[model samples]
Target: MSDNMFEFAFNPGEEVVIKIKAPDLKNKMGGETLQHLMGAKREMLLALRSLLDDAIARTDAADSPAEKTHIDIE
Candidate 1:
């Protein structure tokens, strides 16, 4: 496999976060094709990928939904 081992994750809704990490495109693939992406860390885009993943996993269906929250403003 090439150093182009790139992947991403994205969650779309009220909040938007985009994270990107891949081998320097021009160095290997000359260009890249994007897949799913995740949360954004303006300083280090790469690290954001895991941050979102972990967060989502915590809320995964397999886990108990025993503790959910709802808020309304009036």
Candidate 2:
């Protein structure tokens, strides 16, 4: 490993393992921050899905087009 990006050489079949540790990230704030952000994103996706399902359900039965499950149309 080298600090200078322009000066590094690697063998053709060499195996390299990298380990990174973040004491700050593992601390209270960083851990909680990531957890909260992930939770919010998951909730947002669920809410969006619910809204889409509701809209689809609300469409007029006659006006609604055929639904495709998996097979290609074209």
TM-score per prediction, in order, is: 0.26, 0.41
User: Which one wins on TM-score?
Assistant: 2
Candidate 1: deviation at residue 25, Å? 7.9
Q: What tens digits encode model 1's per-residue C-alpha lDDT throughout 1-74?
A: 33333344457665553333444434433223322221212335445657768888877856765777899989
TM-score of 1: 0.26
lDDT of 1 at 33: 30
Model 1 clash tally, residue pairs = 6
lDDT of each: 0.48, 0.57
Q: Kindly provide the TM-score of model 2 when superposed on the true structure, using C-alpha atoms.
A: 0.41
Q: Candidate 1: deviation at residue 61, Å?
A: 7.2
Colliding residue pairs in candidate 1? 8-36, 8-37, 9-36, 9-37, 9-38, 10-37
